[model samples]
Target: MYSEIIRLKELGLNISQIARHLDISRNTVYQYGNLNPDEYNQVLEDMQTRQKKLDHKREKILSWLKEYPDLSGAQVFDWLKERYPEIDISESTVRNYVSYLRKEYDIPKTIHKRDHEAIEDPPQGHQMQVDFGEEKLKNAQGNLVRLWFIAFVLSNSRQKYVEWLDRPFTTEDVIKMHENAFFFYGGRTKEIVYDQDHLILTSENSGDLILTHEFANYTRKRGFLIYMCRKQDPQSKGRIENVVGFVKKNFAKHRTFFNLERLNEDCLAWLERTGNGKKHNTTKKIPAEMFALEKPHLLPVYEKLNSTCKNSITRTVRKDNTIWFMGNRYSVPLGTYDGTEKVVEVMKVQENILVISDLETKQELARHTISLEKGKLVKNNNHGRDRSKGIDKYIETVAVFFNQPSQAKEWLKKIRAQKPRYIRDQLQMLQRSIEDVDVLITEKALNYCLKHNLFSATDFNDAIDYFGKMQPKERITRFGEADFIEIKPLNEMDRSKFETKPMTRDFNYYKEILERGHIC
Candidate 1:
């Protein structure tokens, strides 16, 4: 073919004319015209030499493919480099050589390729993409630990934000991370694109996506639309997908992970100094700089959206008036538990404090500082105490109920001095007894009992019964003319008589009347 193109060119034919005469493409004619006899011989010799360059390694590569047919070209290249470090070859060279060997040796092609199309960037502050990734790294304790991270990238500016977690992200974690990302960017985009992760999307029904309750509530409050990508289509959110891989390769690779806090601190600093600050390959401008221009176009964050993004969990209050939270127990009000399970809402408001509230009313029940150790019992001292039945209040109620303040104080002092351990029980008993008895009767009974230094509830009741029986009864008597003084008009006779002392009744007369059995 080279000779024919050369012969046509020598017959006074231009490049296109030669291509037509030789029945070849113009590119082929030009390529042949550029090569002379000596260069063609040199190229043949170079091809011969290139074929032998991997003559020894070719057997090894074939053997490796026979043993592990699923090995990728990159993996095979890495293996070759490790075994033959002195070999001078580019990855493309190795890849091409491997492909030729696969075809020549009839090695089965095990790798599959998927087609992807490039996506154009959205308008500034119009869209963001979010995704999660995990890596296994050596921790500070020299143990291999798996860490997860969430990545958020603005579609236009390529501004990246990442949050590292030591565990898999739950729905709450996802929302909290989104809040952190939004705050990091100083605003939010109109829409956020996400993968079909369970933390966000629960299901798809009739072409409508069912988002998780937490994420739905979060988007509704934050006033942002969510776009869920199709399953297995990572290229839909290719910006964040590339960012995740970039983070792992550039930031997390070969890095020592001490703790979650320290790791996150270093991650943020890296993002400021390098990740967002450095020039992006696609945008060709620093992400931080582009983000400055994009900020004004972002959606204005409302004040309501600035509310806490803490994770909330529902816990059942145990019979001991305590609820389990983050592997620790925290006390609630005494009546918060009803011997049965009582559901309470708990939120980790801060690193150390958890706010517990009534699930139905959302009324805050207690705030407890979280314990550092697991299985610990963290309690507020006043949580389970009966506020209405304190010792001092009990004494006051008893004193007022019995109309004997001094005696009540004295009785309490005696009980405290004699049986101090039972003082609370005694006071509680007295307070409860007063609820069932009348105030006047209780007062009389208490007075009688206190007179005898008897403080027991049974003694007070007995005294009350005895006093009730010993009380005098009323008798009816018919009035005669002697019992009644003549009712004269005040003007006639009462003016002078009112000034005079009335004649006193004789005791002997009343005694004689009683003795005569006429009193009845």
Candidate 2:
């Protein structure tokens, strides 16, 4: 076309006449007519060797792939972008370059094979799969925000439900999402499939699944069986996995997220219009229509499943008798810490409160009001009372021995108020003096001190000394032979010295004694 325009212009026809003759626009005719043969050839050459932003860093990219063959093109692009900020290149350009280098260098790539067989459709309401996904999107402020979403799909009907979260889902969040998804579908499946998420399964030991305590309780109460996919096995839960990608591509991509509530509202609208309402590619049936058939076969929602969901974490009590939770240290009871290995369960019952319980006994040890500030200590004042147990017992003993319990208690309270730092040593000193001092003297001294409102231990000791010295001394009598009295037995002639007085027993005497209340 350019040659024809140029040739026509060279044949002496005007630009407008040549455009009319060639059935081309006059602008196109003038644009080609202005370019000389040399300039046109130069333009072709420039097109052949166009300099790309990634050309200068080609050697660096190839070297990275040579060193780490498993690294993806996106990873290499990110690395180069961080190191060489001036190099503006798109991710697709880097990927294409990496693909060319791999083929040119004959680098071996690992090929993964699907381990699970193709799945057949289960009975309606028989099975459902759940999975979580994360996406980075531009919010209304144009700042990049990371959002997480949980996807639930019915295997037979292909119906899907999704819930968006601003942060990573905790165990409680996971349970609540499950409840919401079931409610959205109008019922629960007989069995649910998961990808061994840590929120649900803690570990898989030798083919045996160890579920998290909270999720286990949820399953038990909800009356549903749980199936965990094998490790690294995406095909086991492919239905929900596909749904997760579908959401990202069709709903979230290129979408502005102003707020979480509005984003979710838009997502629900999209699902109603496109996601579940449209015919699925695999099933060729509208999910919403199929869901109506599946609804009746689903299990009924039990009231027992409405129990409060809590995030439980096992934390070791530190030597200071405290546990770390949500960026703060909360106190446990005094004896809660047996050692550093003593594990306690911290349950976040609500937003502001945490219940710390002993793992072995399952008894709540302390209730702490969660702190809003980070790195702050939330301590209970009575947690360290065990440290003062000995002093408290000593004060109680002193109070009882002085026979002025209230006075002793008041004096101790004064000491605690004034000399709290030396209270233990002072109590120990008072307890030691009890062994040496007489109880009566101590009681008398205490009475004097109480009357004068003197609470010092020194003052009480001085009073005891003064009162003891003022008391009269007892007389000591020594036994001697002159003070002894001799006694003789009745059989050895002592009977004569003793007067024999015998009273005759009579009914009248007994009656008079009874009447006088002396004898019966």
For each candidate, give its TM-score against the true structure: 0.41, 0.45
> Which run of 10 residues does model 1 get worst, by summed lDDT?
474-483
In order, candidate lDDTs are 0.78, 0.80
lDDT of 1: 0.78
Candidate 2: give the clashing pairs.
none
lDDT of 1 by residue, 344-382 (tens): 667777777889887667899999887879999988878
Clashes of each: 0, 0
TM-score of structure candidate 2: 0.45
